[model samples]
Target: MPQLDDGSESVEMSVAMLRRMAEQGVGAVCATSHYYRQQNSIETFCARRADALDRLLVNLPEGLPRILPAAEVAFFSGISEKPDLGRLCIQGTRTLMLEMPFSDWTDLQVEEVSALVLDRGFSVVLVHPERFCSSKGNRQKLRQLEELPVSLQVNAGTLLHWMDRRVGLNLLREAPIPLLGSDCHNLTTRPPNLKEGRKIVIQKLGSAFLDKMDENAADLTRQTANATT
Candidate 1:
């Protein structure tokens, strides 16, 4: 799910992008298109995402990485309480990739995550904490989340850029980061740079760091498979 909204189409997944991911050593990709309540209903978004995936798969060449169904759902009030919220999680998994609000988080917003985890029994993966965790208060909030059953996913692009590289490195050093994603959009703007990102990680933290992350990802995927079976 590299380029959900590539500006050209509603969902812009292509074989070319898949090839690029394969070249970069991406074995599987979760197609997490942006999903906000204001845009459309979950039913509508899932239907559109399914259609886009179908279009991509029908024309897909052999030996490309597998695309998993998921969505990068935007945070909103009372989201956890929604009975159908589980439907928006990554298919066959209880994990939900949440894009936190850009503005200052409210108490209710923070509580929603706790409810999602402790009450709803969902594994919450907060996406790209570097973006919102810039402030001391927000960073503290992320630390609080670590106390709960939550995971942090960093973007490869963040680790490569000079401006955000320190933030990402510091987060990895201080917190428990279990996953890394390209957050790729297209070939031109935000291409798949996972290889370069991995290189940086190895250079800074050694290969063991990446091995741990891979183990965590494997565990998550295995749990998903087990649940489905």
Candidate 2:
């Protein structure tokens, strides 16, 4: 899968980087967000975020990764709150790249978010679930999560950064074919590019798997774009 960070950088920065990477041959991107105002609720953030997206959409580069409105949305207080996720956004496709809290959560909390997504007629795509506080014990919980309508998104950084080889492999082994993403942001330490991440998948999972992942990503992104109307 093409590893890409959710575009949380400023619109100009993100656009420039995305345009540059596309010129360099980047395939797809999963624009994700992690920042949430501690003072303001999701409702407030949603309004501002949507306005920002609306402005950005008015002038995007002609050919960029099917920028999906995805999020590293955290499960706050066991509540998977839904902000104003517009249809054009990737997460608006009833596919939230849900992020669990940094600490462990009860199985009930996991179920709550998963069920909330499905109940809302949307799908949940768990994001880098291996990094959660319950990384060890959460396997069984995640296994149950798979039973629902959800997909797993593994962070390419996990492999590229060598933060946890076993976890990445174990997730690959256990979770359904995961969608790979870079989770990149900024031009410095986190320059936007999927080249290195794609290389790791080719080396570890074979080129065939890599191709299929790319195909799936393309298909989903197209579907996301079509949903914009």
Candidate 3:
């Protein structure tokens, strides 16, 4: 599940929910780092990352989701200066989840993220897209990333969203399907949605796809746990 934009104060609740979900056989979470107020200085961002790590290790229950610290890193020109980039990539993840900016981004922005991932020895997982902004046919845009080995993950909830439901469903039908995440943010408004997402996939796609998600999610967490060790 994606972590919220709350500060260090909310880390405890995040850990608790992760524990509960893990006990119920949900083994992994794509923990987003947007909550650290990264718009502040890099020092502040890294401090929040440290606080999140401390809380995760201390309060995390055994046999729960093996927490993998990641970030929906905002990809822009000066992200190279963001200290949290190194922390998230080196600390727990070989893959960094990046969020596209609100506006249509230049090819240079995508290339920059890909290059950073390579420089840090990390792969990239581009998170929930903003409509046709990143579509496949944008040759010049995609050509910028031709050399980077990246995973493009689309949100399952997008199928239900009013804006991208059709596009989301179409992508779901495509081959080499991307990983599905809950992208969950809050308790009430945008709750952890993997369960509902599972139901949706089973209904629309089939039980076989659901089985794949179950197995894949387990393996992903196990790999992350082993990496952290």
Which predicted model would earn the best TM-score? 1
**What digit string (tens of lDDT, one per residue) describes model 3 on residues 1-229?**
2132652336566765675556445765656667333375546655666676776677666676756666667666666445445455424545566665666567677657766666655556666653434545443454455346554565767766757766665545542324567676655555566666666677777888767655544433343432321
Mark the 10 consecutive residues where model 3 has the least summed lDDT.
Answer: 220-229
Weakest lDDT window of 10 consecutive positions for candidate 2: 1-10
TM-score of each: 0.91, 0.76, 0.70
Shift in Å, residue 212, candidate 3: 5.4
Error of 2 at 120 (Å): 2.9
The C-alpha stretches of model 2 lying farther than 4 A from their native spots are: 1-9, 35-43, 54-61, 78-92, 133-135, 219-229
Per-residue error at 99 for model 1, in Å?
0.4
lDDT of 1 by residue, 1-229 (tens): 3234542142344667778889988898777888898887888887877877887777778899988888889998879877577667778888888999998777678889998889888888899888997677777778888888687888989998888888888777665556788887777788788999999889988899989988877765554543321
What lDDT, from 0 to 1, does candidate 3 have? 0.57
Candidate 1 overall lDDT versus native: 0.78
Best by lDDT: 1
Candidate 2 lDDT score at position 54: 72
- In order, how many clashes per candidate? 1, 11, 0
lDDT of 2 at 135: 62
Model 2 agreement with the true structure over 95-156: per-residue lDDT tens digits: 55567666666877876876565655555667777686246667667777777756667777
